[model samples]
Target chain A: MRIEAVALRYRYPRAASEALRGASVGAASGSSLAILGPNGCGKSTLLGALIGNIAPSSGRVLLGGRDLATLAPRAAARLVAFLPQFERMSFALSALEYALLGRAPRLGAFAQPAKADEDAAYRALEGAGAADLAGRRVNELSGGELQLVRIARCLAQDTPAIVMDEPTSMLDPAHARMVADAVRALAASGRTLVFSTHDAAFAAYAADEVSLMRGGSDQFRGPVAEALEAGRLASCFGVPFGAASAPSAFFR
Target chain B: MPRSPDDLRARSGKVLLLALAGLALLAFCLLAGRYPRPGLLDPRLLSSDATARAIVLGSRLPRLAAALLLGAVMAAAGNAFQMVFGNPLVEPGFLGVSQGAALGAALALVAGARSEFVVAGSAFGFALAALAAAALLARAFPFGGWVLRLVLAGFAVSAFMSAGLALVKYAADPLRELPDIVYWTMGSLSGASWRRLGFAAIPALGSTAFLVAYRWRVTALSADEAVVRSLGARPALSRALVLAIASAGVAAAVAMAGAVSWIGLVVPHAARLMFGADARRSMPASIALGAYFAALCDTIARAAFPGELPLGAVTAVIGSAAFVALLARGKVPVAR
Candidate 1:
């Protein structure tokens, strides 16, 4: 599915300022778009709008030419999946059970996941390279391990487009690379991926394009190389930037 | 774990075993009460002595069924409430349903409506009202997330209803109504009869079936709202529907039994301990376990002493003790 947000405008209730101000971005199927922004730059809010979690006050999100607001939640879910930045489980669930919850959109409201759903969950776990972790309790997994399991859950949703909020945040470089690799693999399999991240290195590694957000709006959208230029980086972040000093430059 | 078909089978088998054990306990309670003597009533006496037959069939049977029904409904509703609210500490009691029922029954008693049907009906009606009031108050509150708002709202409503119950008790004639009010608050099945049991069965059992059938959806509600929303389910709508159903079932049980405690709070914990946290397993386990706990408590309440002990007191003592033991074992399964 092709997800495009066209000039989304959103303001939190009781807030003095808007969280999103005319932000727009799009990602085609089999391509990946990385949204890069500083803290409080509305990256998360824009992502929420695209995923239909938040209704944009003055703009429409289009999923394959269909207005997202016009579509039922189940229809939208069948086209796109989402991964939140943070989650807490009330009870202990096995990794497999957690992943199987992704099949909920496909099943009846009162139906349990069947054998085929279980098979699909295992496949998703394997695709994300976390099949061995399926037996582990989700609460017992380390931060990186849990991320892989969560990614597997997203894959199990079996949607063409997946939106992730900080997919590689709060992880060591090795774990971050693992998630980047999973994202790359999913993109290679023709899944549309949109994610927000501070990891410029991961973005350059996995994303085909970059959208730089500033002050609750998109500042620039282009190829990653041009978008990550030192001049653009310095202006976007309001900090001094050197080619050698850039994290992505060093990693590259 | 990669739960195989065998694992699912094993869970089903465990539920069946629990049901069978509960049936056995019910049978034992049937014959082991203070019937012909202080001990077990002879089967031959049941066949030959008309009084013995009448006592077993008329009084003991209905009372035990009521106990079983009360425990099952409370536990099942507790399990649903805890799952739907995503809080192990929450139960039907946390939602003001129990307090509302208590207040309704107290008011009915004070109004000189002495019949069981009128009292239960009033209790059910007020219980639904309390739930609706809490929901409305939560919606009107401009602060906190949905669960937090509802929790605060329920707390306020519960306190209000409890105060109302106290006023009803205070204004009653001490000799005529006070003792009866106190007894009702303590909860009992001593007044259980066929007519009353029939009245409570529809909502209680129907709600339990609804909960058990939709157990997975209930578990889905416990997930983060974003997750539930992304799965094409409206978290707010699903939560409201499940809470309303669970509270109604609880209201019916409380209406009949007059606010039995502990089954709602403790039985689900035990169910989760024995079965995994999956509602598919824990829900049915809760039904069986709850029936057993209530039946056991009521049996002891009636047969353990010449003077009947209060069912609520017995459940509190035993439930608290078991809860402590579960905590000491360090495998409670509840996580943040």
Candidate 2:
């Protein structure tokens, strides 16, 4: 499915200023795009709009040439799967049980998961490299492991598009790379992948294309090489880009 | 390594054995009561004796049914509320719906509505009103998360209801209505009848079915609200619907069983302890465990003395002791 945003704008109910303003971008089917921005630049807001969590006050989000707001919830879920930046498992669901929640959109209103749903959960866990952790309680998993399990849950949705808000923000460097690789594999399998990240180097390695967000709008959008240039990076962040090198620990 | 078929069979046998033990406990509950003879097969009680039939059908049977239904309804409601709130500690009582019902009953008594219909109607009306108050509070304070607002509203409503109940007590006739209100508030199944059971069965069974069916979606609620919305569930709408259904179930059960306590709070935890916390398994387990516990408690209430004890008193005593023991064991996390 192709998702397009046109002149999108949004504001929190009581906030003094708008969170997003006049932002526009489009994601082609089966492509990987990374949103890069400093904190408070509306990256999460943009992701929220794309996933239809928050309505755009002034513009429209189009999914497959149809208005997102007009689509039914189950139909929207069947098309796009989203992973939020952070999640807390309130119940003591086992890893596999948690992953099976991804199949919710496919089941009948009152029906439990069938064998096929279970198989999908298992496969998604294996795909996300979290198969071994499936039997353990989710609360017992480390941060990185839990992140992978959540990704597995998203994968189990079998949606055409996946949007994640800072999937690797809380992980260690090694686990971040592993998550990045998993996203890359998902893109390679002919699924559209859109993710937001602050880590520039990780975005460089993972993104097929990059979009820079600043002041609640898209500043630049192109191949990573052009978007991640020293001049653009410095301007976006308002810092001298090479004075303090990108953390070497991230690259290692 | 793969388990052999023989090993799997042995495990299944152990499970069957435990199930049989549970059944034995249920049988004991059915047989033990205030009557002089306490055997299930005792022909003396079933020999067309009017008093015996009155004891069996009028008192014992209805009480047992009330206990089982109350347990099942409370446990199911508790599970749903806890899941929707994303807190295991939440229950129908914690949300102050029970207190609201109690206040409704007390107010009806003071107003001279002595009929059963008036009592059940007032109880349900105030229960829904309490829930509406919680919903309004949540909307009014959108800055606080949904759970926080709900919990705060519950406390507020509960305090108001308690004060109202106390006022009713003060206004009541000391020799007549006051004692009746006090006995009712403490809770009992002595008033159970087939008609009362039929009236309550609708909401109780209906809500239990809804909870069991929607058990899978409850897991999605653990994610962020945005994520839950993206996953085809309107988090706010679904939560409100579940709360209404679950609270209505509690109201019905309370109306029938006269404010039975502890089942809603403790039964879900017991189910979680026995079965892993998958709502699919936990919902059924909660129902079964609740029925079992309620039956056991009712049996003790009936048999512990020559006359029946208040069901709520018995449950509170047993539930508090069990809760303390569970905490002292230090197996489950104390705080989430």
Candidate 3:
């Protein structure tokens, strides 16, 4: 589904300043858009607004030409799936069981997941490269394995759009690569992707479009190549931006 | 994704077997009591003898039903508490439902309200009040997350309720009200009768049925609130609803059975170990297993000695032992 944030504004209940000051961004249907920003840049807040979690203080959000506020939560979820930041879960559900929970939006209130739901979960796990981890307890999984399982759950959600917050932020290089590959596949599968990340190179590699947010406002919004300039990156993050062609871009 | 259809089939089969075993135990508990002494009564007696039939139906049936209801309700409430609070150590009383009920009951006794209806009603009211106080307190402390804030608020209310109970006890008649308060706090089901069971059944059935029907959604409690919300769930509203229902069931159980310890705390854990932590499977398991545990405990309470043992004492010993055994076996995985 097309996601349009039309001049959205938000502030925490008791906070001194607005978290989002008239920020606007959009992603076309079946395309990948990355909200690239540094810490405390309101990337998470913007994603929250897009998903209708944080109601915009002013302006509004439209999901597929309908006011987002008008849709019921279940209907919103069916149209746009979400993958939140990783949770340090303590409960003992298997990866497969956890993934099957994605079918919750589709199931009736009193119904449990049927065989078709389980099959969908299996397919999602396979797509996420977590098929081997299906039987394993979620809490017992390593960081990479857990992230894969989480992504598999998102896959199982099977909506028209997916919104994610820092999908690879907590991962090691190898795991981050795995997540990056998964993100590309998700985008390629014709689902609108709205994600947040700090890694410019990774965003450039995965996202067709990029919107750079700095100091709680949109700094740049365009094609990834245009948004990844060194001077603009330096200003956005307050760090020297450099391109390294030393046979590896993972560290950058 | 990882599970086989055969494994699921086997589990369903196991559930059936467990249900059958639980039914048999309930029947056995009906015959095993101190009145008969040293051994179980003849099954033929249930039909042939009038006084025996009256005793079995009027007296034993109620107590047996009480045990079943107490176990299932408390276990189900305990499971919901743990899920909504996102804490493994939580129980139905962590939010002060039990203490609130005890305080309300104690006040009723001290006020010379001897009727069962008044006492149960007061207990139920206070139990719901405690939850309200916790919610209000949580709202006041908006800096933290829901689970953490609720936990702190509940602890505060629990302490206050305990103090209130103590004060009521200190002011009561030493001989009559003191013993009643003490016995009620220790928890017992000996007063179980058809009348009391009927009173408790409404809330018990309402809560358990709701929890069972919504068991799948309970999984959302273990996730981050953002994730829960993103999936089209209102975490606050959902938790509140579950807590209300669960606490109502707990209030009914406490009002009926008298502060029965350990079952509410340990039964859900046991269910999780035997089945996976998914509420869908473990919830039904909790109901069945709780009934079995309560029946066995009640039988031991009735049969082990010439006089009936307090139902609370027997369950405490068994529940703790099972908890320790579960830990030793490494099935619980309760990391500090």
Chain B superposition TM-score per model:
0.95, 0.90, 0.95
- Pitting candidate 2 against candidate 3, the one with the higher lDDT is 3
lDDT of 3 by residue, A1-252 (tens): 788888888998999998998888899876899999999989999999888888887978888888898899888888887878757575788899889878878888778889899999989999999999988999899988999998888888888888989988888878888888888888888888999999887798789999999877889999988999999899999999897766543432
| Model 1 steric clash pairs | none
Instruction: Indicate the DockQ of the complex predicted as candidate 1.
Output: 0.68
lDDT (Cα, tens digit) per residue for candidate 3, span B43-134: 78778888778878898888888898899988888888877776667788888888899999999988999798898888888888888898
Kept native contacts, fraction for each prediction: 0.74, 0.70, 0.59
Against the true structure, candidate 3 reaches a TM-score of 0.95
Ranking by TM-score: 1, 3, 2
CA deviation > 4 Å runs, candidate 2: A243-252, B1-19, B37-54, B330-336
Best by lDDT: 1
Share of the reference A-B contacts seen in candidate 3: 0.59
Give the distance in Å from residue A166's predicted Cα in candidate 1 to where it truly belongs: 0.7
lDDT of each: 0.89, 0.82, 0.85
What TM-score, computed on C-alpha atoms, does each candidate reach? 0.96, 0.93, 0.95
lDDT of 2 by residue, A1-252 (tens): 787788899998989999998988777787889999999999999999988888899999888888988998989999899999987677778788888889988887677888789889989999999998888888889999999999999999999899999999999987898899988899888888899998888888888889999989999999988999989998998886764544544342
